[model samples]
Target: MDKIEEQLRLQVYLARCGVGSRRKCEEYISEGRVSVNGKSVLTPGTKVSDGDEVCYNGRPVHPEKEHVYIALHKPSGFICSNQDRDGRPLAIDLLSDATHRRLFNVGRLDYMTSGLLFFTNDGDFSKLMTHPSSHVEKEYVVTTKKEIPGELMEQFKKGISVQGEFFRLKNYTFKGTRTVHIVLEEGKNKELRKVFLSRNITLKSIHRIRVGNIKLTGLASGRFRKLTPREVEQLKNQALENKKNNRGKPKR
Candidate 1:
């Protein structure tokens, strides 16, 4: 019997073509920007075979020959996106000399927040890292414009909700009068800034130092390096482990 040809979801195909992560490609499909064989593809789940012609924004695309995973020390003031309409710098630009593949940041970090960030051309890895069930730990060092407020730490430790967004700290340690190291697993958007702002505290800086088992120990600011094969495997194993541990539990 002849083996059946694998059929891939349209969005997954787009991601293999380096058209951003699978989630981002889904958005592209929803916006009517993707096409198959000259016809618009509005559904992300639409399946296509290897022989089908796929186009993105009228340009044909194919899967990348090799997958690249990069760890970037994104500096403050640079956006994570590939393009910025306001002329702001982009973090992906730092890797222009490193590799030619279209790499998307696995998860986002705000322009003002800098540190360990992952970029990859593989969509499955991106999905695994960003999926809610993974619950991968992210460590950050937050510095305040003034002495770190006592109430702020207490509220975070005890969990607080402002404007319907919940803020909680898995663990925290005071490194200095105005600095604290905090770890979070949920990693909501701009969570640290939101928590600080809720208590009328101004943040001087927010820097991420770790994601799962990957640590930003010697990597310099505004530089990037390819992830070791062992590191990549460890990340996958850790996320899978976390997903297994959190099975049937509600996201907090």
Candidate 2:
């Protein structure tokens, strides 16, 4: 066998190639689902280089030649997953033009939720935006079946506990009797729904509008556009500033 050059851990290589998260790639490796040069590898630590062919689930995985960053207005009923177990539509499937680029969503939006979503081939950028310490703000427009009580609004601002986990909104305002605009720094899974459920509030819909400084304005549902260079820089700056400001603080 030829000696591999520029060797990297198999999991790291998979992540850099936009296959999945490093930890997820580790799971794939441990399950004997990854191969290097035609041999299945069960060790996440196995090293491979540019010269070796890598495959996942019998399909080749290669690093993207150019990074792509896109903002998608995800429509409801599409899942934020690369592969859906139940055969539901995937969010990335909507990016028909970039299917071969190996792009992945940066953060997730539940199947029932809709709005601003980011897809990127840049793993480092994904890590920065999704990291808790970055404290990037995500804003949502929520519509409830009934008017939110004044006390519940106060609880939202002060923080509420649901299922033993505490969640706080950075800010919230009533757009109408049944609609509210809420901002959050922590992107916990189904956090908005969980919080509302805990308060006995029946949520009709939740639509995300913004992340950091990026807004969902002008984008139609199920459509996407490449992010401008300036937009990308602004997002990175926001993450860096948040990380600096929140240093030494506990991550929620």
Candidate 3:
């Protein structure tokens, strides 16, 4: 007999096992990579409960005992990929002392940029923070090699298109002669770099400092810390609120 409380959708169960986000797990199901009770299952909402053997990618999977959310101060030159063909240093490697769970980066920081980044085994949390609909704000401290012209800065605020991709800052303010504090809602890949390149502005560096309500404070470079339960809930609530507020808005 399956207990009602213990039964969950197959995709959700795989996600809890640190396989990937629910949507990714659903893809695996559709590809016939998941099975239950010795039978291949290709349904998204198939019920899974205790006493039923589950396998993902031909390996048995069970929900992790505890879901972990960690904040890591990633340093420059570290790749976010768990495995890279180029043999670059990995940011997730810094958490070798943290835990043995299969943790994945919530969102990626590029190899050259560094600052507040998150790693977690919780697929739901990862999806919430990274989904475009959530509209979570990411703050960055951008330093240019030289002072940027007033006109160029204004153009960034007005938004510009480079290589057919739009780039714009939600808000930006001058921090100093060569530094600007920038906030982005989309955080598109290489967005800042590409825009700067388009205008011939040489960037000295870019460091992310915030994600939604979570700020990069007191965490040293190359260090990691566990997120408090309260912080996790607050972030989730913020994402939900952002999603609710942006409902029906056209995607960029």
Candidate 4:
């Protein structure tokens, strides 16, 4: 059999088909409403190759358009994802004034973790930003309950083994007595919280400041703006380079 040259995750392809957003696509899969080549897929990670038969609710699916990317200065209360069951505020609220294209946040920032959140309709771009291999740098400014010690700072920079998991901040520094800025290349759930807990430090708050080469930059919380052309280009180039680098490495 030939490879799926532009094959995407089945859930991702379902989302692209407008069955719903990506997250919802997973739920449909779990509910057994999605089928590839006539077989139901309950697993979320299955891949859907080009020309594959896809059906949802007994109907064929069509491809959705590439999305437009925007950076939102998400406020402390808004959820990072689309359509929360809790009915809490969502980042989409910030996009009311936006009329050009529908968008979705690339990655997530916890409702409590306010700051830069990327919104885009481009499924491929969103996929790139979230891929672990992208190695995209995400920077955050956080407040700690205890003062950061010098030794801990050095150790954080050097990396540590916690619960058999190796971790480190790509960069870390004390912003004040109980505050600091840290950068990481991965986005494990509750990762920052775990990083602090492992060091016996309590995380008071987390505010993301940057993603890839784009910074929040003067955008007030609860507000959003379309990405500039140059900013978009840089992100695409960065993702491309990361992909190329990964392709050259040996698989684990």
Q: How many steric clashes between backbone atoms does each model show?
A: 0, 0, 0, 2
Q: Is candidate 1 or candidate 3 better by TM-score?
A: 1
Lowest lDDT sum, 10 consecutive residues, model 2, at 1-10
**Model 2 quality (TM-score):** 0.89
Worst 10 residues of 1 by lDDT: 1-10
Q: Best to worst by lDDT, what's the order?
A: 1, 3, 2, 4
Candidate 2 local lDDT, 96-208, one digit each (tens): 88556777888799999999999987877888989888889999999999888878878878978887888889998889998999998877899999988877889999999
Q: Each candidate's TM vs. the true structure?
A: 0.94, 0.89, 0.84, 0.79
1 or 3, greater by lDDT: 1
Using lDDT as the measure, name the better of candidate 1 and candidate 4.
Answer: 1
User: Model 3, 135-217: lDDT tens per residue?
Assistant: 89999999999886777778878888899888778898898888998899888888889888787889899999999888889
lDDT of 1 by residue, 1-252 (tens): 112179989898888888988989999999999999899989889998867888888988888878899999999999989779999999999999988777899999999999999999998899899887898889999999888877778888888898998888889999999999999987888889888887788999999999999999999999889999999999999999999988988766
The whole-model C-alpha lDDT of candidate 4 against the native structure comes to: 0.78
* CA RMSD per model (angstroms): 2.4, 2.7, 3.2, 4.4
Best by lDDT: 1
Model 3 bad stretches (over 4 Å): 1-12, 22-58
Cα lDDT of all candidates, in order? 0.89, 0.87, 0.88, 0.78
Better model by lDDT: candidate 2 vs candidate 4? 2
Model 4 stretches with alpha carbons more than 4 Å out: 1-9, 18-27, 33-61, 99-102, 246-252
Clashes of 4: 2
